[model samples]
Target: MGKTTRYRFREYHVTAVADPMALPIFEAVCVTGEERNCAAASGELHAPEELTRWIAGHCAQTGHQSYEQTTRTIVRAEPGAWQ
Candidate 1:
């Protein structure tokens, strides 16, 4: 089993997933309007607040403003035996 935290910025879709397969175990700030979006990873799991801060930095890097988290979903990107 795994947990995924998805957040919506003004022009970004940030998601941090607790999956071993993910580099550093998390990914963040996928720019919504670009065909070649840059995704960043973290070495460890972060709280939603931390992830939001990361998202803000990512947005600020591009001179964009990030709003609040629009949604949070616990998705099972991988299949396995779990209760």
Candidate 2:
């Protein structure tokens, strides 16, 4: 039997959220499989559009496929987080 190549993903948290005004302070939403080893509070808040573009650019540069699919997995403004 041959060894399996496990798919590893990394999560990068940006200073954003579903409802930034919900809490006393705006907290970032955690996105998985984007930036590599980025600190939770490393950068400023990025809107949904900006975030998706950022991911696509990163993936294209790194020769990673499925960036488009990953972009569709983000949460919407409404409830039921599965989109």
Candidate 3:
């Protein structure tokens, strides 16, 4: 008979981190009309103001009031205490 084998698994917790070296990225898309349109905008992760400014400019130029914003952030997973 084969020897009995066992394995252990550990739980992990994921959290977002803003590292200067690997700054998160912010992406915004204009969705004002019936169909998705306009060029996508992207900027630094920590600075949302820049994205907002771009959105405002796009809205003003294209008379668009609606927009979809996507934030891409870095995350780290750490093992949690064994339960």
lDDT of each: 0.49, 0.40, 0.69
If the candidates were sorted by their lDDT against the true structure, best first, what order would they fall in? 3, 1, 2
Clashes of 3: 0
TM-score of 3: 0.65
lDDT of 2 by residue, 1-83 (tens): 99989997765444333444432222232233455532222133335555555556655655444322221223334423322
lDDT of 2 at 3: 96
How many pairs collide in each candidate, listed in order?
0, 1, 0
Error of 3 at 41 (Å): 4.1
Model 3 regions more than 4 Å off = 1-20, 35-46
Task: Tell me which residue pairs clash in candidate 3.
Answer: none
Q: In candidate 1, what are the lDDT values of residues 7-31, reduced to their tens digit?
A: 9655433444555543332335454
Worst 10 residues of 2 by lDDT: 67-76
- State the displacement of the C-alpha of residue 22, model 3, in Å, after optimal TM-score superposition: 2.0
Which candidate, 2 or 3, has the higher lDDT?
Answer: 3
Instruction: For candidate 1, list the clashing residue pairs, or say none.
Output: none
Which candidate leads the pack in TM-score?
3
TM-score result, candidate 2: 0.28
Q: What is the model-wide C-alpha lDDT for candidate 3?
A: 0.69
